[model samples]
Target: MPTSQPTPWGRARGAALGLVLVTVTAGALLGGCQQGQQRQQQGETRRQEQALQAAATAQRRDLDALVERCQAGQAELVTAAAALSAAEAALAGLEQRRYSPLPRPPAPDPAVLQRYSISDQELELERHQQALQAWEQEERGRRSRWREEQRQERQRLQARLQRQRQALSAANPAVLSPAPEAKLNREALAAFRSCKRETLASLGS
Candidate 1:
């Protein structure tokens, strides 16, 4: 009779304990799974970030050279344009001069009918002047074309430089990493120190 009286309370306590144990076990398993997943994701992020950095570093020297060449081309283009303008102005001035009319020479002697000899010299001079003007114009056109081509080349180089820089930034670990920029900055500092030490060692040897 006494055992029967306590049966309901004992059964209730066992059921409550079993439920608590099952819940705790499930929570611990779930925590483990979450931690594993987090670690896996972090490893993947690290791999991706490392690949991007390597790619950027590999291209750095080439990109720097391209930027330098582009700047030089831009300077050359500026000088060429100035020279072209000066040449064009001189050409315009020469073209504006009026063509001289043929000059009449003195009438031949009337004593004996003599043929009037045309001054072929004047015609030759005129022809030379025309040819010189044509050459100047052609030279100006060629210079202008060269200037345009240089400008286009400079623009293409600039665009390529910008694209390379943009790609480098996009692939930056600071952008992709879960760590803050400040931490990445510290890492960079450490890397720089290591590189400097290595360089010094090589030089000393």
Candidate 2:
């Protein structure tokens, strides 16, 4: 018995069908890979945006902390100025007593510093002639030390502020809002401005 051979048309049709299947399969695979690549790119972009947001939030938190710390210290500056004013008034009154003129003023009244929480009680003596000389020497030593301590503290604060300024170029504009210290008395506000100017000046040095 003779087996029948396939016709040319039949073979051609079979090969065409195979080619169509191969083309469809290749297109599906390429499409799947493209979708996966797009998803990866989108995920990476989202992660970067999230990281930037977190960093900005952290920076704002740090800046707010600094603002609150400085605001809390405003009362201390006002109290110090008040205490100095009181001391000056008392000295003026003492100098007017020409009949028994005291050569030196006694230690400033420590009462003025009571509310300011100044704990030093060394100058808590009664203003009298007997201990006037001794009081002067003690006051001198205390004043000198206090000035040096305050200066160092100011320098430390200024240095931190300088670094903050440099680090916060992209900080929010709200950081420029006036602090609570702005409500202080004119003299005290001026003092704060002077202090800030000193801090800024240190940046150049």
Candidate 3:
């Protein structure tokens, strides 16, 4: 019987070793898995052992397809998890200072400073400093009243992010899983990595 598939292994043969159907015959492939073959070949055999070999050979192709599907699903989950992590990091880095870091009040202008004597300059500096400090303190109080305003936006983003995380986890809790295990050919591995890269790139990262 001829090889069969949704994706022809012939096309991927060059890209993936030992993953091609056309390049490797069934007998050659089965030879590698022959531990109990000696016993099976004895005692009233009707080529059934070879039939089982062909069955296994066909099953392996099916397995290869499944491997690709598993990897693709995993790759999408990985990409989404990376995005959520980035969002969390950005949220943590949000500027949320309760006390407004008002800049140091500007110094007396150059022309004005040039006209003042040393004593006068000292007196002016002291007055200006006191005045700026008092103004800044009051300004901070005023600003503090509205500090939580931006906080509301941050909270909204956080809540939305949390909801998204929960929904995604509900869909596939494997996102938080330990080290993953999935069989992959060379092309499939490359495809999986490329999926992640394209996802990040689409997000403008």
Stretches of candidate 1 off by over 4 Å are 1-6, 68-79, 87-205
Q: Per-residue alpha-carbon lDDT of model 3 for 109-150, expressed as tens digits? A: 868977999998888888889989887897888787667666
Q: Which of 1 and 2 is ahead in lDDT?
A: 2
TM for every model, in the order presented, reads: 0.34, 0.37, 0.37
Cα RMSDs, all models? 18.4, 20.4, 23.5
Of candidates 2 and 1, the better by TM-score = 2
For model 1, the local distance difference test gives 0.52
Alpha carbon lDDT of each predicted model? 0.52, 0.55, 0.60
Q: Clash number for every model?
A: 0, 0, 0
Clashing pairs in 3: none
Ranking by TM-score: 3, 2, 1
Model 3's alpha-carbon lDDT is 0.60
